[model samples]
Every structure is written in C-alpha cells, then in structure tokens.
Target: MSSTLAGAFGIAALFVAVLALVFAVQALRAQSGTAKAVTELAATPEPQQQAQAQAQPEAKPGTVKSELRRLSRELEEARTELRETLQHLAVVRYDAYGEMSGRLSWSMALLDDNGDGVVLTSINSRNDARSYAKEVKAFESDAKLSPEEEEAIDTLRKEASPTLGNPDHQ
Candidate 1:
C-alpha cells in the first residue's frame, strides 16, 4: 500500500509539471503576440496616418465644403491676376435688328474684374445701345498684363448662381 501511495503522488506531480509547462508555453505565446502588435504599431508613421486621414475623407461629398473653400482661394488668385479684359477675349453674337439675311452683329468684349474691358463690334443695323457686361473678374491696378492672351481668357469665370455658387464650381 505504501508503494502504491508513493506512485500516485509521483504521477500527480508529473501531471502538475506538464500542466505548468503548458501554461508557461501559452504565456510565452501570448507575450510574443503582444510584442509583435506593439512593434507593428511603432513602425507606422504619424504623418502618414494623419495624411491618410485627411486624404480619405477629402474624396467624400461632405468634404465638398472644404474643397469649395480651397477653390475660393484659387479663384481669388486668378481674379487678382486679371489685368485687361482684352488680355482675355469674350465674344458676343446676336441679331442687331432682329431680321436681315444671315446675321446682324458680332461684338467681342474683353475685361477683368471691376468691368474694365473693351468691346470691338460690328452691327449690320445701326443701334444706339451697345453691348453691356458686368465685371466678371478684375486685375490689380499695378499688375502688368502678359502677352499670352489665352491664359488671360482662361482665368475669366462666369458669375455664380445660387445653386452653382459653391466655391468649387467657380
């Protein structure tokens, strides 16, 4: 009986040892997993995460508001650079007297903000009222106009409507 009791105790100790070893192994694996997660997090860049955060939402419709604000800044820059309206060219064609052959008149207006531009025009029928327009965009008083005319016209924008008034549209 004494020998049998001694054997049972030894078996229990062996079982306990195995259980302890398993527990230790599990603990090591858990620790390693935690360490791996920490290392990966540290490897990431703060600025990249921030940039991605800004970039992802910038594509959304909600960010359209923000985009409009940015557009306003760009539009302001373009307007500031407009010197002479002729630096940009706009043409208007319409019937001068409302009837006669193919057409009546062609008028081209070039202008910047503050409604400063000229109209070079021809009318088939004589009229007292000439073509009129509003200031669409203006150049600063001191800025020199560039000889490249296309860039000047490209900067002129149509006036904004209520629905189209979103700065991004301009």
Candidate 2:
C-alpha cells in the first residue's frame, strides 16, 4: 500500500513538470515571433511622409483666385494705412468765373483730415479765403465724370498709393 501511494505521487509530479516545460516553450516561441515581426517591419522600405504630402493635389484655379483676392484686399488695406500715415488727399470743385457779383462763395475742397487737397475755382471773388467741402464718395459709379476732373482724380490716385515693386521695397 505504501509503495502504490509513492508511485502515484511521483507520476503526478512528472506530469506537472512536463506541462510546465511545454508552457515555457510556447511562451518563448510567442516572444520570438513578435520580435521577428517587429524586425521585418523595420526592414521594409517606406516613402518619406513629407514627399508624399507634396505629391497631393494642388489648389484649384478658383481657390487660387480667391486666395489672391484676399491677399489683394489685405495689401490694399496696408497701402491705405501707409498712405494715411504719410500724406492726405482731397477733391475740390467750384465755378471758376462767377458772373454774379457779391454772391455767397460756392467753393469746396474735398480733403483728408490733414487738409491736403487741390483748391477749386473761387466760389466768389468777394471772399478769397473761404472754402467749402465736397463729397468724394461718388467716385464709384456707372456715369462718367468730366475729363478734367477725372484726370485730376487720376493724378491724385497715382500719387496717393505706393507702387507694388517700388524703390522702398528695394
């Protein structure tokens, strides 16, 4: 009876040892397989992500145009600010020779805040220094302006803004 019990206990220990060895081998194989997979991935060639990004589609013409328009608007605002910083502009309009004597002067000068603008025809010969203001907001319209007036306005426009590639940039 003692011999039988000892034999049974030995067989159980052997079985447990064999099972533990099998499990250890399986664990080692799993770890090795993971390492090999990582190595293979590292060895493969891959295109540069930046180069792939550059290969993407360019902006469409309409998108480009809209962007250009936005940039143009910003530039125009900058130019306006620069001009305001440097100089001023105005418009003047009045009758040159008034036949009516002693009439109230009807002269006006459209001017910037700094009072820089062209002097128009004298409203009245009676008053030499008196000047009025003109509305310059009508520059945008479908109607045509007087040739001389338009020319003067164009001259002011040319002088008011900076050139795109001006000497200042250089």
Candidate 3:
C-alpha cells in the first residue's frame, strides 16, 4: 500500500509539471505577440508622433495660434516665389547643318509656371558654334523661333498636362 501511494504521488507530480510547462509556453507566446504589437506601433507614423519626434519646444496656447498663422503666411509666400522660378525645361537636339551628321546642335526652353522665360539655341559646325537666346512670354516669343526651339517649348507644355496635350485643356 505504501509503494502504491508513492507511485500515485509521482504521477500527480508529473501532471502538475506538464500543466506548468503548457502555461509557460502560452505565456511566452502571449508576450511575443505583445512585443510585436509594440514594435509595429512604434514603426507607424502619426502627425502627433512626428511633432513630438521633431522635439519642438512647448508653446503657450495663444502663441501657438500666432505661430501657426505666421507659418501659414510663410508657406504661401514660398509657393508664390516658386511659381516665378524657372522650373519647367525641355531640350531638342538635331543636325542644324545638312553636312553635320552627329546632331550636336540643340535648343532648350526654360520656363516658369506662367510660361515666361527664355529659349537658348546652339548651332554647331565643324569649325565654329553660334548661340542665341530668345525671350519667351506666355509660351510665345517676340523674336522668331526656329523649328527646334518651338518643339522644345511644345514638349514642356505637353509634359505639364496629364493628357500630354494642351495644359489649358484640363
């Protein structure tokens, strides 16, 4: 009877150990899932998080509103200045002379958002090169434009539109 009781106690101890092992595995799995969730949350960017990440100094309530208004004005001024910048550009290369086969001559158009800028052309020959600049206003030039120069301007206009047609169409 003593030996039988000892064997029964041994079986109960084994059962308890198995139960503990199962619970430990479940807890580890739960902890890993929580860790992954935390990592994902940190990786995602929210506006508030970005502001905090920038480490901007805290401002008084009234000052914050005034600062935002000043920033808004500055942003508008930057946008207006950008419109006047010559950001649109295109180039056309062709053989200007019948004897020149390498197509080294080229015409380039540099324009702003308002289609105001200049077209520069370079005519290349074996012995010499000639360069010219024509002022453009509203995509048109007071001076006569060569075919290559006109093509360069047209290319920039087409590129500015989604349909690759007239920019005014949309």
Candidate 4:
C-alpha cells in the first residue's frame, strides 16, 4: 500500500511539473510579443507623437477626433492633387510609312487622373519630318488617332493603373 501511494504521489508531481513548464513557455512567448510591440512603438519619434498630443490632452476624446479629422482632410487633399496632376505618360516608336525602314516616327501620350491631356506624334522620313498634337479626353482623342498614337495611349493606360505600383502614377 505504501509503495502504491508513493507511486501515485510521484506521478502527480510529474504532472504538475509538466504543467508548470507549459505555463512558463506560454509566458515567455507573451513577453516576447509584448517586447516586440513596445520596440515598434518606440521606433517612431516621441516628438511627433508629442506634437499630436500637445494639441489636446492625451486622454481627451475631442483631441483624438480632431486629429482624425485633420488627417482625413490631409489625405483627401493629397488624393485630389494626385488625380489632377499629370501622372500618366508613354511613348511609342514605330515606322511612319512602309517605305521608311527605320522606326524614326514616335508618339507620346501624357494624361492626368481624368485621362485629359494630349498626344504628340512626330513622323519622320528621308524627305521631311512633321509633328502634331491632339487633345485627349477620357482616354480618347477628339481627332482621329493613328495606330502608333493609340498604342501610346494604351501603354500609358497600362502603366498608370494602380496595380502597377508606379510611383509616377501615384
């Protein structure tokens, strides 16, 4: 009986030890996660946070609301500027005529967020070179576009799309 009781006690102790080890490991993981979060928070300068906090008390609800509103306004302004700015551009080079062997002729498309801009084309040959400009609206031109001019606009459309992650489009 005594041996049996002793064995049971030993088994209970082992169980407790394993439980403690598991708890210790969980605690360490939690601590590591907390430390990482704190480090990330500290990476930002205190002055900037303080500047934001200075506008109102750190604990005030109004301050947080005001800051959010200001940030929202700034973001809208930036987006507006980005849309109005000339952000899309492309150039297409091709042979102007079948007789022209060299790809000396070229077309360039420049556009804004609304696809309002101009396409410039320069046709070159042995005899003479001619350049012309056409207005582009909503990615389409009022004047008839040559194949090269259309290709230039298509290139700009592909490049200017947000999925391209082109900084110039931004």
Q: At residue 123, what lDDT does model 4 achieve?
A: 95
For residue 25, give model 1's deviation from the true position in Å. 1.5
The most accurate candidate by lDDT is 3
Q: List candidate 3 stretches off by more than 4 Å.
A: 1-62, 162-170
lDDT of 1 by residue, 37-84 (tens): 456434657466446546655534544344443554466677555432
Q: For residues 1-170, what per-residue lDDT tens digits would candidate 3 score against the true structure?
A: 99999999999999999999999999998778666745643565646544653575544555433344355457667867777779888999999889888889999999987778999999999899999999988888999999999999888777755522233332
**Per-residue error (Å), model 4, residue 140:** 0.9
Off by over 4 Å in 2: 42-170
Q: Residues 1-170, candidate 2, lDDT per residue (tens digit)?
A: 99999999999999999999999999898778656745543454434423432565543655533344345457757866553342333344444446544444333333332224443423455446443333343232233444444554555556545642142431
Among residues 3 or more apart in sequence or in different chains, the pairs in candidate 2 whose N, CA or C atoms overlap within 3 Å are: 91-110, 108-132
TM-score for candidate 3, please give it: 0.58
- Model 1, 23: alpha-carbon shift in Å? 1.2
Q: Please give each candidate's TM-score.
A: 0.28, 0.25, 0.58, 0.51
Candidate 4 ranges beyond 4 A from true positions: 1-72, 159-170
Q: How are the candidates ranked when ordered by TM-score, highest leading?
A: 3, 4, 1, 2
lDDT of 4 by residue, 1-170 (tens): 99999999999999999999999999998778666745643564656655654665544455434444456457757976777667778998899789888789999998887777899999998899999999988789979999889998888777657623343444
Best by TM-score: 3
Q: Is candidate 1 or candidate 3 better by lDDT?
A: 3
Backbone clash count for every predicted candidate, in the order shown:
6, 2, 0, 0
Name the 10 consecutive residues with the lowest summed lDDT in model 1.
160-169
In model 4, residue pairs whose N, Cα or C atoms come closer than 3 Å (at least 3 residues apart or on different chains), thus clashing, are none
